[model samples]
Target: MFRLNVTTLCAIKWDCVIVDEAHRLKNEKSQLYKACYQIKTRRRYGLTGTIMQNKYIELFNVFDWAAPGCLGPREHFLEYYGEPLKQGQRISAPERFVRIAEERKQHLVKVLGRHLLRRTKQETIGHLMRGKADNVVFCKMSDLQIQAYRRLLRSPDFQLLISKDLPCTCGSHLTRVECCHRTAPDGVIWSYLHRENPDGCECCPLCIVLPCLIKLQQVSNHLELIKPSSKDDPEKQKKDEQFASAALGEDAVLVGGLQQDESFMGMSDAQHCGKMRALEKLLETWLSKADKVLLFSCSVKMLDILDRFLVRKAYSFCRLDGSTPMGVRQTLVDSFNNSPSKQVFLISTRAGGLGLNLVSANRVVIFDPNWNPAQDLQAQDRSFRYGQRRHVTVYRLLAAGSIEELVYSRQIYKQQLFNIGVNGTSEKRYFEGVQDSKLYKGELFGISNLFRDLLETVFTSEIIENHEERLTGIHRTSSEQCAKQGLLGEHAVSSKLEIEDDIENSELSALSQEQDGIEDEIESPNDTQSCSESQYEHILKDAGVLYAHRNEEVVNLGGAVQKHKRPKTKEQICSMNDPKTLIPSFVVDEHQRLATPSTLKILSENGQEDDTVGQKRKYEEIFKLEEMDETTKWFLSGSSLCPTQSIDCCKAVFK
Candidate 1:
């Protein structure tokens, strides 16, 4: 009917066609794009809150519709402009390429700036809103979920997904896809069923990349998502049963198992999920405080799980997802806002991420993250936007050291790219690649990293401090301050800070000769500070919180809420700005145990150490490192090596 109406609509020869939410026209190959293009019009205009979400190519598609050929051919634009900008943004990119990338970025901005009319949310709606706090809550997986996750990684299906792109071990110099794994031993092509495929066939021996990822993601959310739905075919159901049984035990095949039984007094099904357990605690606190909550998940199945949990807990809530009727969504939103009894609004991220005014709910919990950062951002805006009176707090619950971390990492990567492209902002190049890949692997992209377990203990204070600096825009303290803090300890505490200030000159002059070249390296803009394993202090109070930090509150001036620079105490600065300085001298000496021989020599000359035997042992370790393979050395180097550099270094040396 839309096709027929579209033809009649086009015949009218409209004078103008204005498109709202114009980013939808990003895919020129889409039917909607083609249909919209058929309309006869002399003047074309488009409006969108987000013109470019994940890539520069999206901007090309939007511009192509508004003013055809303004940005030139897609292939030409991508090659000459997009690719260079992306390459330049890489952490491992050479200094020369970074210059070229900046040049390309400036040129593209010039071209787009002519037709683009941009206004940020801060500019438009800043006056109407209060300060918002964003918090990332990392939830530890349940014992069952952890075992199931590890087991799934070793499954044949997952192994095949990862192995297909690897250089064949047979030394064929061809990828497994091009060589042995191309066809099965039975001469049948290897492929898994598409997640949306209605007519299920016999389970294939091999798995597709996307389906395998969905399975992994499901395990992180709730094991119930991995289980076959009731609508699935019997064959598919049987295969899913076997798959779950193989990863988990046969007892896990019953979804929530005996948790439904009133007689069963063990942990509830909701408690079995790490995210749900966190949500349970949060909801208890928030509801008791009379604070409304908006819960969002990318999966409707996850929403269903939440719905059951809410019902079992006897909490009043409203739900909106893809299954909800278009007309009814607004009604649900209005009811949630007007009725104080509706303490929770269960929303699917994709379905309710946009065009919803959920300001009544001051607390938002993102149960799962989306690959696209914009979706998550939009969801946050539902509560944090204009007319929100109460201070909004957003909790992004993620499984600790799991696929969710990788997903969140990619979100930050894309967000940096977006900021660099649209806002003309400079960002720290923390990743090796701009895009995640299935065919190739890097620090941020790889099946091996995704599958491997990350020790909560391995990350250093520098990692947290760097992250805090990026998010909160606070300057870090100098190494001199760090050394002073270490030496002074609690003895330096004084009501009047003038005493500490008075000692600054003497401290600097006395340490000038001793610190020499180390100060320059420590102060380098691109260089991130490194600490030894013993200096790896726990940043989060709870092991479940893989990482947690909050942005400072914005100052309300007139009606606008904007961030203001404020004075901070020594403790606040150490905790928020330079976490590494909190490490004591003992930890530093322990780190010195792994120092290079040059450092050992300097330490002896400075009379900082008298243990010559330990120094000798440290010097021998350097020789041992030289003898070890590059891969082994990378493992030993730990946080000292830049992840971007290691990818290239390991690839060249190993193969």
Candidate 2:
């Protein structure tokens, strides 16, 4: 009744849908078949070699969708085609139903033949040339699996045995016919009990029953002790000897009953490891020639083993399992489609089988087959869809005689059931009748099929030898040719610097000298006192050469020095009290104004006068003489002075 959205249906319009191991969809009640039915598409296809399995009804779900309403409803079809039977009975299909199924199948083939394609590797690809197919059979279980199975089987309180109450704990009151506890002791439990608890009680008698019976008895006894006592008194004991007798009678009657034997103990880790290694070797051989491949497995754990092998061989690949995120699943698909270097795409059939296009790959490998043919076919169609250029080849690597083969056989039978239009009720009835007998047989380990599968590869040593030879050749030539051609040229350098011949060193030298001169000029104040007179002379000589080359303005040293001096006023006294006036503004000007004999005499007299009556007396005498002639004194007073301009201090002093 569920409907798909228009957008989703539109997206799938032209896309091809491949139902892998098509036998699985034989049952119309399967979720896979229901989902496929909801897909709206024109190019529908199914890929399965074992299309006709045990029962015809197996193909009902597929044909129902491929050609809707072609197969009649469950009741009408069964009424006409099937015969009723009792429990543990199989209903035989009539000739009419078989003909209808065949006709429907033929009609489906006619309608969708162009879209559908299937080819076994043996039929199409012939013998693979590059890689070896190897099979290794390991006869050991992982430590954990072994321990867990042993714990379950050997424990005195295993649920199945305890529920049956096989030990007869009431001291024998009930008759054997009515007693619920009726099973023989298994060997493993008996061995443990006999070794540990030597004192065998009446109820725990040693018997020559099957090992499973011993297991059941041990579990029942454990359950009896743990059962709640009826009386309120904590220490109350049963005093009825007759009750004990009855329980004993029940035990006696049930003592010889048959049960399943203990045979699963034979499955060991060594066995699994050996078989897995053989499978890995086989896959390696197949991968050697394939440019792209898809490996399908039911168990994620098996996929993990293949992943490890691929990693060891340095093959680049991607893995998708039930846990893969939906968003990332498409990315992995796209990567597989586009990447040439990635050779293997490891996918769990359940996770990556539906809605993925992998037509770029021409090779498909099924590592292990599942009960559902539809699931296997869906997984294979990932590569065999539209846009697939080459003829797609599928390799089904089945363990010839293990539980895998048995499951495969069941799948085939289920497909047949689908073709017959068997209803869910009928299927369930069939399953219930055969569930205990067909599924749970007594075996030390139900791995005989697995052993036979590995033995097939062992017996055929030529395949392994051929694979090894091919692998050796591929490895030998592949890397050597790539290595001989180096990555770069011998003369290649990382960086190169080019030099120009036109640049002159003399110009640079001249610029450096000019910089040095500017630096010296900045330091001239400090060097002025440090330099000797001879050094000054050499500097003047260098300045003269530089001065002569340029049309420089000639500065008069006498006139420039005269411009810097402030003329001394005749009215001012040059004493410590007038220290500002005593210090000459320019030494050259002071010396020049005092250069005349009369002026020198006056200055000398002023100095000599300081020793007698102090320098004040000399200044007083000069001022007293100046007071007699106003005009002469005013003329003699040096007041008109401009330090930056030409000064007439000589005329003022002489007048």
Residue 605 displacement (Å), model 2: 99
Candidate 2 lDDT (Cα, whole model)? 0.39
lDDT of each: 0.60, 0.39
Model 1 Cα lDDT, one tens digit per residue, 1-655 = 5566897888887789899899888888888888888888988899988887777788889998888889999999988888778877675577688879877876777687777878766557655555565666667787788888887776766666556678987899898866665433211112234344433234432445566677789889987776656677876666666666666775573445512222222223675577887687667766876888999999977887788788878899999999999999999999999998999999999999999999998789999999888899899999988788766668888887678877877776777677667655445555665564443345566655555555242221133333323322211132235446554334222211322333343235324522321111011122122222122112222234444422111100111111122212333222221222222333332222222122222222211222432322332233233344544443423323433344346556764
Q: Which candidate's TM-score is highest? A: 1
Name the lDDT value of residue 419 in candidate 1.
62
RMSD of each: 16.9, 48.5
Candidate 1 Cα outliers beyond 4 Å, as residue runs: 1-4, 183-207, 250-268, 436-441, 446-543, 550-655
